[model samples]
Target chain A: MAKYRQIREDLRALIESGEYGPRALLPSLTDLTARYRVARNTATQALKELEQEGLIQSEGGRGWIVRPRPRPRRHGIDRYSRSTWAAGKAILIAETASQGMVARQQIRELAEVEAPEVVAVRLGIPVGTTVWVRRRTTFIEDRAHQLADSYYPLDLVEGTAIRQVDTGPGGGFARLEESGERLDEINEELAARMPTSREAIDLSLPPGTPVVELIRTTYDISGRAVEVMWSIIAGDMSSFSYRFKIPD
Target chain B: MAKYRQIREDLRALIESGEYGPRALLPSLTDLTARYRVARNTATQALKELEQEGLIQSEGGRGWIVRPRPRPRRHGIDRYSRSTWAAGKAILIAETASQGMVARQQIRELAEVEAPEVVAVRLGIPVGTTVWVRRRTTFIEDRAHQLADSYYPLDLVEGTAIRQVDTGPGGGFARLEESGERLDEINEELAARMPTSREAIDLSLPPGTPVVELIRTTYDISGRAVEVMWSIIAGDMSSFSYRFKIPD
Candidate 1:
């Protein structure tokens, strides 16, 4: 095998065996060169290969470190059950608590804006209709986990607490229900893709990490779409669970 | 703004505006240099930025081309409903037909192997217990879309047609039901990550593409875990849709 490839394989085995655990620093390029009797470029190539494989990351001057693989937060359909959220349970906090992690959210932007084309279509509103949008970044263990943007039609939530930065307990759905738009169903679509440079930085994602885009539309008992939420979740830090019966 | 960034923004706007449609090749580096009065490296840098953003691809000697964003195939819970698959409806073919696209599957491997740790856990089997695994790559419109591997307890399927490369009619589930194991429910978990080099090559994924990993466990009415399927779906080519009532 090529010298650089041999080095790469050795390092990969080490990482997989848990010898180099998550976030643990790997030997510096200088050390690798000295131990393997290879040039600095060869050592660098080994680390670069690992980075491209999403196994390690170069931390600026701190050198390469095993990319941390946190226990993924599992999101079950039960999170949307009225018993959980309507009782004032915050979804993020509840999920994090199960994993013994702390959770918080920073409200980034809360304002009334023109509904974008996608949001309008989902909400059954006219193009460019005014809407209320609440954008926030959710954090777990002090690290950004996802970006959520919830949009509501102006007529549906104009003067409601849903327009505020803090929607109080149970979040926006509760507020909507209290306003008489009791949520009856939810339609969720999930897609995964590479994060944009901006998203990567915002989520502190490692190189090669992807993000899952979840778009959910909540419908009232009267069959009206009341709220549409778009979430960009850090793929490495989360997994979504769903259970359903197979209808005959 | 830097010259390369300015060029990138212009190209991005063109792509977003549909002026440069999917799979459309951009101007050659020479042409770009002449038109923008810039060095070849500057034009190359602009294209590299787009590639990293998952917007374009370098086709070796053919140069850079806009990445084709095929209309994603949406998967809903109904796909697993007994009415769909029990009628011998092949999931992939039915899904593709809905999109007016062609679908095919190539069975790569059918054999009995010791269950891996993850599969064992999901199947409620002891580690190293033998299991039957069927591996296949699914294609849509002649492009690879996903890799699926289904595992069954060896003892349960050892002498059955389920071990065949093609499980006739309703696929594996149908045969299992005939064998007295009626599926009652399914548990699905989804996570996304960068594909390994082998997976990337097999799926023909672009530089920045990711794969959604879906692990589904099927349970019989008796609550026994009967089958576990692991699917690595090409992120750029698919989305999963699910709709359910918000439990009261």
Candidate 2:
């Protein structure tokens, strides 16, 4: 029993060490059996344990691959402030691409859904205002992990390129930046909740995976709320940090 | 249907307006019906919707009571330079109570756990080092919302008052201050992930909420990792911001 457990731990170590990058398939069970000098049955046991632990998944004839993990992206914490963007200089930007992480996603726009009353109030808009909602599902190695829905006031972004939803990743924010609306202030309300059935399916989460919710209101130079982004991230694979200087 | 939804929305508004705080039971269904000029059925429907939305929970004998809605605990955007702390004494001191909005959580020290492989690598310590793992939870409305499992080198904090841990709530850094270690640098990594079953239960999450994972390494003036604080926050209920200056 201990040997099986040890093999599982060792396999986990390889995944963590980036020996098998995100979404990379692992060696076959036959290969594993030869490498570790273990019986074929023992190799099977090790693979089963890894699958149960959410470290890897089997893809039919494709063999097993490292479970999609959120490659931590570190942006210059300064990029968030209005002052930093004003300078418009190249600063340190952390990319998961260098780590070879890929996410599959679909982005779509919804018209005229009744904005939830809680959201309506937060925007100071009348209930039932026609709000443009952008919805997305992000996948890792073909497995769902994040679901995000952003609501924008129809009048503000209507006729803008934002209306034509971009199916590619990172489209919304990039398009908004191109439109010359300086994202001035962002007020974010973060929370957590159990996944609804749809969320569970969309995130490809196991039966009980909880999701982090980020409700963000991005403002213009005048500090008027122009865009509200609601992001749901998989809880197990991401983290966040910010840097601030104490006010003089 | 609209009228009933309106009543529900209004009732929710009243509750959020703090007319009824957490653990405050609603008026009898009869009274609410009279006040809203709606039938008992309509009032009951409103209550049911609220329950489904997780704004209130019923505990058998206890009719509907306000559920503690997780709110963002403001994380100031500022640099941690010693001069900054000394200069902003007044503003810094005033923020101690967290704007008097969210309730503070108390933390205590229990038995310490040995270093895990990842922590060992981050701390630049040998694997299996005897690092003290301090477990604590932050509470709001008598419920835990933030769970921290911090690892420290026993040699640094052992025999000092910090190893004893505070029986209740206070800033963790302030405790270190007493021990003559002034925090000069902090390196933090932030990511998002789905919460485990234990995290969901401890945070009182409804079902599918994810969590924000923050790993912070605090160094004293000499630039060594003294304490590694790992914080788990309900993703939907938290937002992080920080401001820093470009070095001249």
TM-score per candidate: 0.90, 0.56
Q: What is the C-alpha lDDT profile of model 2 across B1-248, one tens digit per residue?
A: 56667776776777767898988988778777787788887787677666644567776776778777555555454434344444433222334344564345455565667788767877889988888877777754455657878888887676655566552223445556556776667766666555554576688765334567778787777766778878887665665654232222
lDDT of each: 0.86, 0.62
Residue-level lDDT tens digits of model 1 in B8-100: 888887887789998999889988898889999889878876786688998899988999888888887877768867888876787678778
What local lDDT does model 1 show for residue B84? 69
Which segments of candidate 1 are over 4 A away from where they belong?
A1-21, A24-27, A30-53, B1-21, B24-53
Give model 1's share of reference contacts. 0.86
- Every model's TM-score on chain B: 0.89, 0.62
lDDT of 2 at B116: 81
The prediction achieving the highest DockQ against the true structure is 1
C-alpha lDDT (0 to 100) for residue B233 of candidate 1: 92
